[model samples]
Target: MSFVSEFRSFIAKGNVVDLAVGIIIGGAFTGIVNSLVNDVVMPVVSVVVGGIDFSNYFFPLNSAVTATTLDAAKEQGAVFAYGKFLTVIINFLILAWIIFLMVKGVNKLRAAEEKKPVEAAPAPPPADIALLSEIRDLLKNR
Candidate 1:
């Protein structure tokens, strides 16, 4: 087969298509999780921690770096941005928790499905077999 045709066949496979769809969805989900962390959860956490913006919290490596915000600190000199790291850690934890819950729910559903009893209905005999049985019964009656 031609290279183009082989590539086309590979792309047409179910697993490849499913992986592509999963990547697209995962990207969108990452955006939502980022928003949840940056906007909603972080804001509440900020309120609890005396309204300090964690993004702005950092330790300047240089004495000349006197800027308050993380951006300005980076502009002046190198600094340890532990606050941003903390925020990212929190984000990862939340995402992991959500994924864990989703997995747990799916497992529960699978368990429930497994618990269901499957009844197999008996199949009818073929026409010739049925006729032969009927003839044998008639002869027995005689």
Candidate 2:
């Protein structure tokens, strides 16, 4: 097949389409999670922890370059931005927890569906067996 045809065939697959949809949804979900962490969770946490911004927490490696914020420190010299790492870790934990709850709920729904009793249609007897049974019944009546 030609390159364009091969590419078209690959993109036409169900799994590939599902994966693309998943990626788009995941990106949107990430934005929501980020907003939840930054706007809601962080503010509440900051209040509880004396209103300290974790992004501003960093250690300057160079004595000559003294900066308050992580960005400023980077402009001057090398600095260990542990605070940003901590914030990222917190975001990841929250996202993971939300995903876990979603998966758990989906699993519960699936389990409920599985537990439902399925009423199957009764099978018909073979023609020969049915005829023999009918003859036996007639003989018994006689």
Candidate 3:
């Protein structure tokens, strides 16, 4: 087969289809986790901690920079964004944990499926055994 045909075949394979589905699902899952962290978790954290806002949680390297919020600092052309980096790290950890749990669940289901016993077909009597039975019947007839 030509290169193009071979490539098309590879893409149409079951593993490739499964991988595409996984990527789509993973994207959707990421959106959910992002919403949870930004809306639910951050709001609660803001209420409890009272002063720690991950978005605004940055140290201004430039002493001349007098911006109250990280965004404002960035707007004024400031550098060194530790807060955004920290938030990204936290988000990555949460996403990884959720994905890990999902994979673990899938693995468990696969294992259970594999553990199911497969029934075998019954074996037929050998030709020699059949012939012996025929000979016995013939002797009885005699």
Candidate 4:
């Protein structure tokens, strides 16, 4: 096959299409996960922990940097931004947990499907085949 044909065939493969779709869906899912962590979960967590904003949590490396927020501190000088890192870690953990639950649920469904009992006996032969068999048996007797 020519290069163009080979390339087309590769792209047309089921796994390649599935992977492309997965990547697109994953990108959209990342946005949803980010929003959940930043808007919903973080706010609830902030309330529980007395309204502390993790994004602004950082240690200024330079003595000259006196800004409170991480962004402002970075504007002034370098800072160790552990709070942002913590938030990202939390987001990753939540996303991983959700994916794990989804996979577990799918596996359970597959197992249940597989466990369903199959038909114990095979179906009877077609009419013509049964008639042929009867004639064959009669010839053998003669």
Candidate 5:
């Protein structure tokens, strides 16, 4: 096969198409999760934790940097951004939890579908054999 045809064939496969669709949906889902974390959850957490913005929390590595915010601190010198890391870790945990719940629900639905009862098909003997068996029984009775 030609290179172009081979490439086309590979892309036309169901698994590859499904994988591409999954990647697109996953990217969109990530955006939603990020918004939920940054806009909603973090705000509530900040309120509960004395209204401190974790993104602005960082340690200056050098005395030259006297900035209070993380952005200014970075501009002044090297700094450890553990607070931002913590925020990111929180986002990851929330995303993982949402995915876990979704997977669990899907698994439950699949289990329910699998648990459905299936009727078994019945098999009948040949008419000649059945007749022979009946005759034998009648003769034995006589």
Candidate 6:
């Protein structure tokens, strides 16, 4: 086949297009999870622990990375973002918990299905026994 034809076929079937859509949705989902972790959950946590932005919470490594907080490190062109890492870790933990609950619900449904009783088919009578009963009836001369 020609290269154009193959390329056209690849585009027509839509695997690549589907992948692009999936990537876009995944990006959006990540943004939502990140916001939930950084904005909503963390603030609630901060209230309990005297209000601190964990994303801005970090330690300075050296003088090259000037400034006291994580924002300063980035301002002076520092490579470290330990606070970002912590925020990501928090997101991962929350996502993991949500996934665990979904899986647990699926398992419970599977268990309920398994617990359901299966019916057994009735047994057929033996041909020899049926024949013997017929012969006995004949002998009795009904």
**How does each model score on TM-score?**
0.76, 0.76, 0.75, 0.81, 0.75, 0.58
Candidate 2 has its poorest 10 consecutive residues by lDDT at: 64-73
lDDT of 5 by residue, 1-142 (tens): 9999999999999999999998999899999988888899888999999998988889888899899999989999999999889789998999899889999999999999999997787777899999999999999999
- Best candidate (score: TM-score): 4
Tens-place lDDT per residue, model 2, 1-142, is 9999999999999999999998999899999988888888888888899999887888888896688878888999988898888878989999899889999999999999999999898888999999999999999999
Better of 1 and 6 by TM-score: 1
Q: Show model 5 residue runs off by greater than 4 Å.
A: 1-3, 119-142
Counting clashing residue pairs in each candidate, in order, gives 0, 0, 0, 0, 0, 0
Identify the superior model by lDDT, candidate 2 or candidate 5.
5
What's the CA error at residue 72 for candidate 1, in Å? 1.6
**Per-residue lDDT of 31-62 in model 6, one digit per residue for the tens?**
88888997898888888988766778666556
Which residue ranges in model 6 land beyond 4 Å of their true spot?
1-29, 119-142
Q: Among these predicted structures, which one has the highest lDDT? A: 4
Residue pairs in candidate 6 whose N, alpha carbon or C atoms collide under 3 angstroms: none
User: All predictions: root-mean-square deviation over Cα?
Assistant: 6.0, 7.0, 6.1, 5.0, 8.2, 9.9
25, model 1: CA deviation in Å? 1.1
Q: What's the lDDT for all of these models? A: 0.93, 0.90, 0.84, 0.94, 0.92, 0.81
Better of 4 and 6 by lDDT: 4
Model 5: number of clashes?
0
Which residue pairs clash in candidate 5? none
Q: What lDDT tens digits, residue by residue, belong to model 1 across residues 1-142?
A: 9999999999999999999997998889889999999999999999998998898879999899999899999999999999999889998999899889998999999999999999878898999999999999999999
All candidates in order of lDDT, best leading: 4, 1, 5, 2, 3, 6
